[model samples]
Target: MSAFAERKEMIMTKKTAYEFAYITFAMFIISCSIYFFLIPSGIVVGSISGLSMVLNQVINLPISLITFILNIGLLVIGFIFIGKEFGAKTVYTSILLPVFLAIFEKICPLSESLTHNSVYDLVSYTLIIAFGQAMLFNVNASSGGLDIVGKIISKYTHLEIGKALTVCGMITAATSIFVYDISTMIVSLIGTYANGQAVDYFVGGFNKRKRICILSEHYEEIMKYIMEDMNRGVTIYSAVGGFDKTPRIEVVTIMTTSEYKKLLNYLHQSDYKAFVTVSTVNEVIGTWNINKNSRKSKQKEVSVQ
Candidate 1:
């Protein structure tokens, strides 16, 4: 291959490796939550695993085996109906989760609750599983099972995936009433709601950005810090003060939360009188590129100059 082609191949290989690593870690977290807390307590938090839990009571099969079979069936459905991309993204996670659970069971089998309090177990497992699933979603993947159903519903109805998943989860949680007591069923409903909330929280946080507007006598300093130190782009717009009728330069920039915090601290120390307004930005689409390695080299060049 040519040099450019070889480099592109290398980049693609690295990206695929990174994606698999992330998915593996996320699935492991889900498995740990299920094996340690959810399974033993019978919380039934509403998914394929929850359904497997309910089925295990009657079928006398291993939860891992049940999850594996269900996920395999879902994979076939996803491939046929949803699309190839969804199926490819979900296949590894769907299979790995059950394998991880099986390994966990072999290493440390649990006949009783890890904690004496069922509420604590439910809360802990709910949060862990939700966060892991959120991570998977952020990477454009899923844990298979009912998520495949959610995807199918979303495709035909044009519904949001979150709403679709919630509906599916509620239905799965409702089935818990038949297998467990009323109290368990109630916890399952609450866990389902909490799981959705947790996913929203994590996903929102992952994508959150800050839009900052600054009207300052020290616009040059602020702009320099942002452009040079932070390696972020800024737009300078001319503005006329409404009260004073004075011409001014307004500096606007978008940055991640950590970068915003650092900029805030720098502004406080450098220009205490600088007027600043900040807002949470849900989405940003632009051609501006912020490459960390390139930024670091540029910073070093600036410092040397």
Candidate 2:
């Protein structure tokens, strides 16, 4: 094989390994929340697992069985709609979640709330599940439940993942009304809201980037530093100074937090008196750091990776 192909395969293999490692850890976390906290406490956080809990009350099915069956159905839908990478990762995590729950039940079953306080249970489940979901969402994969629905909504309607999840979660929360008491149902709804908020917070922080605009006499030097040294793309725009009407070149680029920090440090050390503006961008669309023609099919949707 060619050297380039060998290197490319190596990189992909490493990335795949990392992705599955992350997926496994994320599933373990979600399963912990569902089996130990959500089940015993009767607090539903509005995912498929949450719905399974309600269904388990009516049918004689275990939560793991309900979740496994529902996830298998959703896996087919997810594989058809979403890209293969996402679908594949979701498959692993979705199956792993139920397996984890089953094992947890066998090894150490909790018949009562770990904290004995519904409020504490609600907080624990919300925080743990949100973090787990955010981790999967960050990798453009989900734990396959209502997450499949949320991802579909996000893909078609262009809604943020958090907002899409909130919509699905509210529906799941409403279902609990029939099975749970008024107080438990109300808590379920609140937990759903908190879950969405926490997911948004984590996803936003994970995907945040800096949109930077720089104007300076040494603009070419700055541009060179960005493109050649940092291996990032920059756009050059011709602009006129508003006050003086003097023509100038502006360098615009988007970078991660660490990249922005490096640029700032470079500027300070070099004593470059550059006019700079920075904005936090929560989402970026289209091709980034890749050839436009290569990603024409994905240009319309947001690139989570």
Candidate 3:
């Protein structure tokens, strides 16, 4: 096997390990939200666990058992609608959530509400669940339950994933009325809205990059640094200044936070009078070419400039 191929395999193995760690931690957080906050408060937000809670009231089954059964059913639906890749990742999370819930139930049961206030419990659940959901989404996985529903909604209707989650959650939240008072039901609805917004915020912020456009006489030097040192691609365009009517070369590139900082420092130290505009990009589509290209050479001489 070529050295490059071996390195690629090693990178893929490392990435898979990282993703497993992330999935586990994300499920643990969601479990904490359900067991520590939602269970005692009886707040039904838009989630599989919420649905399980509602069903448990009627069927007299354990909440964890109800959740596991519902997730099993949802997983099949997910496989049919959301694609096999999603179904595979979700299978892990769906099972882990129920298992984690059972573990917490046995080890340290929350016999009573932690905050004793519905609003506090709702907020806690929203914050923790939102963060966990964002992490899963970043890895192209989900926490199962309403996430599968949200994925279906977004895929068919072209609605944003976060909004889809809110829509599905509101429906689940409405079910709270069957089990709780009007006031508690209202709290659930509010919690559902807040949860969607938090998820949107975190999801959008997860892979954010800076889109930078630079107009400078030293465009060649800047572009070279960006390409060679930063391992980033750049696009150059010819432009005429609207006000000054001066011909200028515009260099544009998308950079991660650290790369942007390094470029900023390079410009400052070089004392270049560059006109730079930066915009926060939430996501990048297509090939971004962020990684260094592997060479076929097994061994190469090292040189320090």
For each candidate, C-alpha RMSD in Å? 4.7, 5.6, 3.6
Better candidate by TM-score, 2 or 3: 3
Off by over 4 Å in 1: 1-12, 52-70, 76-86, 150-163, 178-181, 218-221, 224-229, 268-272, 285-305
Using TM-score as the measure, the top candidate is 3
Q: Rank the candidates by TM-score, best first.
A: 3, 2, 1
User: Which of candidates 1 and 3 is the stronger one according to lDDT?
Assistant: 3
Clashes of 1: 0
Best by lDDT: 3
The per-residue C-alpha lDDT of model 3 at residue 275 equals: 90
Model 2 stretches astray by more than 4 angstroms = 53-64, 102-114, 289-305
Put down candidate 1 lDDT per residue, 1-305, tens digits, no spaces: 75445655665677779888998999999889988988777667789878998899989999879988988898999899967867898988867977998899899988898887889898989889878887887677888888788778867897655677778888999988888888878888888878777776776777779999999999998999998788788999999999999999999999999999999999999989988999998656564434454456555656766
- Residue pair clashes in candidate 2: none
Clashing pairs for predicted structure model 3, backbone only = none
Instruction: Order the candidates by lDDT, highest first.
Output: 3, 2, 1
Q: Per-residue alpha-carbon lDDT of model 3 for 6-108, expressed as tens digits?
A: 7767766877788989999999998898889988876667777778878989999999789878888888998998889789999999779879989998999
List the lowest-lDDT window of 10 residues for candidate 3. 296-305
